[model samples]
Target: METTYFTKKDSIVRQIWGKADTILFIFAGAAAEFALNKAVDWLYYTGRLPKDPLGRLFSTVNYAKVIVFAEEKTAFQAIDQMNKIHAKIEENRGFKIPDWAYRDVLFMLIDYSIRAFEALERKLTLHEKEEVFQVFLKVGKGMKIADLPTNFKDWEIQRRSQLQDNFEYSDFTKDLFLQYKKHLGIIRYRLLLEAQILMAPKRIKELLNFRNQSILIAIIPFYRLSRIFKIDYILKELILPKDYKSDIKALDHSAAH
Candidate 1:
C-alpha cells in the first residue's frame, strides 16, 4: 500500500523544510521575533525556553519535521499532541493563550519559511509562496486557531498588521536575548543576530535595533560554493553548539526519509 504524507512529496513546503540550513535560518528569525512578541511570557512560564533555548529549538524542529515529512495519521497525532501540551499549559496558567497569539506563531512559521528559504536558496514564485502559506494554514486549522486569513493576499495584510501590533520590546525580550547569548557563546550569538538580520522583517529589525545590513548577504555566494564543495558543514560546526552537532546533521537526512 502506498503511504500518504501530511505534506505532499513534491510540495514546496517539503523543499523549504528539507534542509538543515534553511531550518536553522527559520528558527534564527523566529528567535528574534519570539523575543519581542508580547506573548513571550508564555514561553517563560515553563522556564525551558530561557534555560535551554537551543534544545527547545531542536524540539520544535523535530515537531515541524514530523509534520512536514511524516505520514498523515502520524502528523495529526503530533499536532494533537501539541494542542494538548498547550492546553495543559493554559490549565496551569489559569487563562487561555490568546487566539491572536496562536495566530502569531502560525504566521511566524509561514513567514520565516519563505524568508529563510529565499535568503539561503532562491526566490520563491508567487504560487510557491502561496503554497507555503497554505501548508501552515492547514497546521493552524488543525490546532484550532481562530481568525486565520483565508488566502495568501489576506495573510499578507494580516501579517503586516500583526507585525505592527503584536510585538514590543519588553523585559522578556531582554532576558531572552541574554539566554540566547549565554547558550550560544559570544561569537555564535553574534552570528545568530546576523542570521536574524538576513531573515527578520523590517519591523523586527527596528524592534531589535538591528542594522539594515548583514554580512551574511555578502557571504552567501561563498557559502553556496562551499555547499557545492561539501565544506559547509565545517562552518556549521564552527557556528553551532557542539552538543547539537548530531541533531543538526540529522535534520539534513530526516526530510529525505
Candidate 2:
C-alpha cells in the first residue's frame, strides 16, 4: 500500500484534523473564544474583523490546518512565520500580547481537539489525546509561548485556571458577535450559537446566556445518520457561506498530507 506522509508520519494529528466535521467543530469552539475573550480584542481592534469576522477567523483556521498538515520542515517554517506576525502585532501596539492570552489560544486548540473528536468520532485514548497535545505543544514552544504546562494533565489544570482569569464579555465581544450573526445570517447564526454552547466550557456558556439546552445535544444522532447517507454535504453547504465552500471542502484528511 502506498502511504502518504500523514498515514506514514504524523498520523495522529492527521486523523484528528482530516475530517471536515472535526475541523468545523474546532472552528466553532474557537469562535466562541474570539467573541467572549476580552484579551484577544486587539485582533478586532484594528477594524479588520468588524469588516469581515468570518473571513478573518476562517483565515486563522486555515493557517492552523496548514501548519498541522504540512510536512515537518514546512510546519516549522509556518510556526516561525506566525511568530513573526505576533512580533509585528506587538511592535505596532507598543506592548506584548499577554502570555495568558497566547496560552488561551493554545489551550482552546487542545480542548477543542478533544471535544471535536470525542463528539464526532470515537473517544481518543489517553495516549492519543497526549499526541494531540504534543503537536500543539511543539508549536507553542516553537512560537516561544511562555509557561505552557509540562504535560496534558498539567495543561488541563492550567486551562481551567486560565479560563477563570482570562475571559470576560466586553464591547468588542458584543460587537464581534453581532458581526458574526450578520455575516452568517439568522438561521446559521443560531446554529453557530447552539454549536458553541455544546462545545464551550460551562462558564463561557453561562456568560453568553447559553444556559438553555443546546440544539446540538438533540442533533448528534441525526448528524451521524446523515453521514451514512452522505446528507452531511448538503448540510455543510447550507450552513457555510458560498465564498468559504472551497476552503471548507479543502479540510479533508488527504489535504493534511
Candidate 3:
C-alpha cells in the first residue's frame, strides 16, 4: 500500500513549513503571543517553559513537524500523545485547560503560518490560506478541541476576537520575557523582538508595546537574496544561539530530504 501523509505531498502547508526561515518566523510570532496569553500559567505550571524558553520552542517545533511530515497513522499517534500529555497536566492541576485556550493555540498555528510565509515569501492565495486553516483544523479535531470555526473566513473572525479577548501583559508575561532574554541573551533577544514586530498581529504588538516598525522589514530583501545564493543559513545561525545550531539546521526539511 502507498503511504498516506498527514499533509499531502504537494501541499502549500508543507511548502510554508518546510523551510527553516519561515518556521523561525512562525515561532517568533508564537513566542510573543504565548507570553501574552491568559493561559500562559499552564505553560509555567511545569517550570519547563520558564527554565528554557528556546528549548521549549524547539521541542514544540519538533512536535509540529512530526504532525506535518509524518504518515497519517504516525501523525494521529503523535496527536494522541499530545492529548494524553495535556490530560495528565489537567489531572495534576485539578481542572481542564480552557477550551478557548486550546482554540487560541490552534489559531496561532494557522495565523503565524500565513504571516510568516507572507513575510518571508509571498502572499498566499485565498485557497492556499484555506488549505493552511483546514490542516490545523483537522489537528484541532484530533485533539478533541471543541467549537473550532469550521472554515477559513469564520476562523479569521474568531482569530481576531481571540486576540482581543485572550491576551494581556500579566506578571506571567513579564517573567516569561525575562526568561526569554536570559536564555537568548541580549543581542539575540533583541532580534527576536524585531522578528515578532514583523510577524505578530496589531493587538499583540500593542499589548507588548513593540514599535510599529521592525528593522527586519528592511533586512528581509537582503535575506531573501542570500537564500538565492544558498548562504541564508549563516544568518539563521547568527540569529540563534550556538547551542541550537543543529536544531536550527534541522528545521530546513529541504536539507534533510
Full-model lDDT, candidate 2: 0.81
- TM-scores of all predicted structures: 0.98, 0.93, 0.97
The residue-by-residue lDDT of candidate 1 on 1-257, one tens digit each, is: 99998888899999889899999998898888889999999988999999998788678767887798888899889999999999999999999999999899889999999999999889999999999998888889899999999899999999999999999999999998999999889999999999999898999999999999999999999999999999998898888799888888888886677
Candidate 1 has an lDDT of 0.91
* Cα lDDT, all candidates: 0.91, 0.81, 0.90
lDDT winner between 2 and 3, please give it.
3
What value does the lDDT take at residue 27 in candidate 1?
A: 84
Candidate 2 lDDT over 63-172, as tens digits, reads 77887777667777888898898888889889988888888888898899888888777888888878888888987888899998988899888988988888888887
Query: Which ten contiguous residues of candidate 1 have the minimum total lDDT?
Result: 57-66
lDDT of 3 by residue, 191-238 (tens): 999999999899999999988999999999999999999998788777
Please count the clashing residue pairs in each candidate, in the order shown: 0, 0, 0
Model 2, residue 249: distance off in Å is 0.6
How large an RMSD does model 1 have? 0.9
